[model samples]
Target chain A: MTPISFPDPDFIARQTAKMLLEVKAVHFRSDEPYKLTSGLVSPVYIDCRRLISYPRLRAALMDFATATILRQVGFESLDAVAGGETAGIPFAAWIAERMGLPMQYVRKKPKGFGRDAQIEGVLSEGDRVLLVEDLTTDGGSKVKFAEALRTAGANVTDAIVIFFYDIFPDTREALAKHDLRLHYLATWRDVLAAAREGNHFPPETLAAVEEFLNDPLAWSGANGGVDRISV
Target chain B: MFDQLLECLNEQGAGVRAYDACARMARARVSEEPDNAAAYLLLAYVAQRFVESYDDQPLSVEAASEEFQQFTDIVKMLDKAEADASADARIAALNVVAAKLNTAPKTGD
Candidate 1:
């Protein structure tokens, strides 16, 4: 196998964003805002899962993912790669294969009964596990998955995703509080940059998306979505 | 378990190894229970991949229509299995598969 090349983070971010746009994995709507599971209505939505359908794009992204993790976290620091159930599973699988590490997946909820019920595959005590996901908005789900892994005796100090909603002010702090060092390839800003470069949408639509990204809660409130994020 | 299968598919691309893994899993499920909808649904997913692998090629109108009809038939079978499956895991998996099928990109879209 050829050695993986580690490109500059900015280049990776821009390329990933471009791939996302090219594949139509992104949606920009200002007229009819989309509501998130967190009740934050916004003009931008992304379906990273769509990347799976585009074979070439998916392969490139996974290569970038492997390089990003190795460079940012270290090649040998991780013992196993565990994906947060559902969307994260495929990405984790590819990453684990690239890194040649054991693979596992953390469920959203526990299965039958036992300390390791919430985890599938083999997880040993003190294993340094890297949690993989498609994206993170508020880092809430990552924390939950990390907590589960920690409970099962795995050391989950770092988590990675293809995209990150960097608009959330406290997202980094939140992940830090859970002892998870978050690594990602791109963010909304990168997507916006890609959009601007490609002229993918009308200026007005892009402006609306930027406004929502700047202050999601306020925008959500003004747009008939939940005003405050309930803890 | 399904996660592993998806990982296998993704890592190997649409190669024989990936298809064989999916086929084996589907076969195992069918052998365990003759009317397993979830297994058939998974097979249907694999069939979808076959169509996707030919995305760059231009096909005859008749050929395209035949593939579309086969896809719809698999989906119909999955729907029936979703209604009939008794296990919670199988039902949940089928629901996820159904949801994916609904959101999947249309041919040529």
Candidate 2:
């Protein structure tokens, strides 16, 4: 792999956030919060999958992803790349080709009669697999995919995503319990920073988003959304 | 022996060494009992993985078609095993079938 210069994580985060904003992938609605599957109601929402539609933007982000992984985890550390089912598949495909490693995808559920049923693609017993996803809300899906990969005999210690909803306070602790380190290009905080700098949203809307980010469940409760994230 | 393989297979970070162990054990079971549908299913699962590993390759049209045919063959083997395999094995085989269907080549591809 060609050597890549490491940019400050903050810079990458802000740039990624700006790109998301540019693509109109981030939505902020404080008055009527969007209900998350986890049950938390929020005034902020983002769809990282939109990045895939813009080839140039996606390529730049992929470069940032490869650089981030190489800098944080080392270039030679990974044996293969695995995307988390649907959304993660394209990103993983690009990254795996760039890194010249085999690629696989993890299904949400098992497909066949063996331990490796949940995994699609050839993963060796000691293959150091890097799990990729589009975005993480509360880090729940990562844990599930990582467990499935582990069940299939792949060593999964690291997972990366394009966006992370850093609103939840316990996401890191939850993933750490599974021995899966989480990496991402940007988060709600970074997006908020970009919005503030760019004046992307009305001040009130931005303030509402910040309030929701600071205490999501509380905001959810006040806004007629679930007070606590279920399970 | 199957239980041990399952444990290793399910264990986090077991890696290629663990998968190899499982494959070997599965093959051994098939050798001992050629009629064992479960063993055949396991082998099919392994074969599916092997086929998927080639997805990143820049295959020529002919190569891609060949690979797709191989994948279809594996899915067929798993379906054949499903009739005689245990309930767990049947579920597993079906899952593989579903995954294969999702990626199966379109007509004329």
Candidate 3:
């Protein structure tokens, strides 16, 4: 039998960023500016949901996700892989298959009642569960999912996302406050760098994106968007 | 529950297929079965499609806003339905889209 091998973190990050661009999952419209449901106006938007359509790219990313989990947290660290609500279910299922672990999903709200109302699969008490999400910004949803897991008596210390906005300075601190170690494959920084290398967009657009990435909140505020993010 | 919805949908028959009729049927379903998100989604779809029926018309700015707001009231329930992680919500969303297309008056290409 041959041992499984994985790409280094930098290589994985670059590949993940490049794939996101290839699939057109990342959008930058600084001039038009999109209004998020959160009421913030932003120059950037990402739809990780689109990844599900591209089987090859999605498979590669899931492999990278499995590698990241194993390398960072060790092979024996997780008893189950749980997805966060809607978008996270498929990603968690794929990763759970790769890791050969039990799979579960945390609902946004409890269905009826009971200790595990928010949980779908059979999660043993004290099982170490890693919550998976397609992407996260300020870690608000992660906190809620982690809290739900704790309420159901699962041991959750780490959460992984396919993409992390990373522009928010308080995201890590917020997750840590709840004792969840945030792990992810790529971020907007990697996507910007990949865009630069590929000359994907015109120089002006890339430059504008870089400026926003450097100090996102200030740029957003200057552009008539929210300057500060809560949670 | 959807069997009953399908029968009510069929009773509408061909012709004008009024949005008012769709709303009335959906409301009746809600009264009979309170937790019918699909009924609301289907009704909302009918309203959106009703708006689409006026696409190429010379609707004034004021008229267009009024037409849109008429259906917008039914849209808030959509988030409550979409946010649900259960298979029931997923299936409901899918079924309503298909059902809406079947019943909605074809407006454009």
Candidate 4:
């Protein structure tokens, strides 16, 4: 498919947000905050893992992801697709199929001895790897996975995630610092807009979520969560 | 193991021929009792041809995974056999293909 034939980015974002909500991937609660892995308490919690459970939604999401990557990165740019650990595995698998490229998964830690320790599946040295994951929060995990791919002799310059936190300022910079381009289908802002437009939650809850999104560290600090994000 | 992987890769590289072979093998194996893992692995190896030969219209990863699991089971069974070195090497090659297939993407879609 040609790049322009793809759905508009704005439209994709809105629809992706709606799909996430429809599948109950996004949860909003003001009274009881959800604790993040980073130890941040927030009114909104998103579990992209749920995306794998819905076939229709998963297909649409993969289409959007495939389109975005194709638009941002050339269709022939990638040689292989690598999924990070458990959660990223399925998404990576889908992307690899869409791209019709060989697929592999990177373990969080080395599986055995040698340089290819963290890698599973056959990875040709110097082959370009497009890392895939379900979502990115601080983007830390993607960086870690990309590094592993690089260490295993993969030229990992691009990564795709179904969702990106988009709240953290350093997320993109951290990715760029590692020479990785991050491609995502939807983000926190997109979810927030969809939530507001759909009235998925109370106005106050949406506002609180918006506030948390606007200044997450400050909001988390005030809300009895970690103020500083450890690199 | 490398030789079989190369064979699978060659079959994938062969385009329509691989697809026809895989389709024929898949149908043939369907009538067999309990399904042979080798048959499934062969199907998956051939399915990669359809995936590669065609563009945009993606093969169902679910279909790919079924053959992949079959291939993996065959490898596991061979590993348990504790056969001679040549048989073990042959199993090893098949397992490489199986491992590749086992990681085949799941659409869940």
Compute the interface RMSD for each candidate structure. Answer: 16.6, 18.2, 15.0, 19.7
| Sort by TM-score, top down from the best | 3, 1, 2, 4
Q: How accurate is candidate 4 locally (lDDT)?
A: 0.71
List TM-scores for all candidates, in order: 0.67, 0.67, 0.68, 0.66
For TM-score, the strongest prediction is 3
Error of 1 at A205 (Å): 0.4
Error of 1 at A51 (Å): 0.6
Q: What DockQ does each prediction reach against the true complex?
A: 0.02, 0.02, 0.03, 0.01
Residue lDDT tens for model 3, B1-109: 3433333322332112223345556666656665665555566466446534532122222333343343343343344455675767756665655654586444452
A194-225 in candidate 2: lDDT tens per residue?
99999999999998888888888788678654
Candidate 1 per-residue lDDT over residues A1-231, each given as its tens digit? 213588899999999999999999888877766655454556778889889999888989999999888898997899999999878999999889888899999987689998888999999999999999999877877888899999999999999999998987878987887788999999999999999999999988899889988888888779655565421
What's the residue-level lDDT of A177 in candidate 2?
89
- Backbone clashes for every candidate come to 0, 14, 0, 2
List model 1 lDDT by residue over B8-53, tens digit each: 4333332222344455655565566565645554664655464444
Give the per-residue lDDT digits (tens) of candidate 2, residues B19-101: 34445666666767665545445554553353344321122323433533554455465556556557677667656655765
How well is each residue in A1-231 modelled by candidate 3, as lDDT tens digits? Answer: 111887899998999999999999988887866533232446788889899999999989998999899888889999999999888999999999998899999997689899899999999999999999999877878998999999999999999999998987888998999999999999999999999899888888888888888897788678655566566
TM-score of chain A of each: 0.97, 0.96, 0.95, 0.95
Least accurate 10 contiguous residues by lDDT in model 2 chain B: B54-63
Kindly provide the TM-score of model 1 when superposed on the true structure, using C-alpha atoms: 0.67
Error of 3 at A37 (Å): 4.6
Query: What lDDT is reached at residue A152 by model 1?
Result: 95
What residue runs in model 4 are displaced by over 4 Å at the alpha carbon?
Answer: A1-4, B1-109
Compute fnat per model. Answer: 0.00, 0.00, 0.00, 0.00
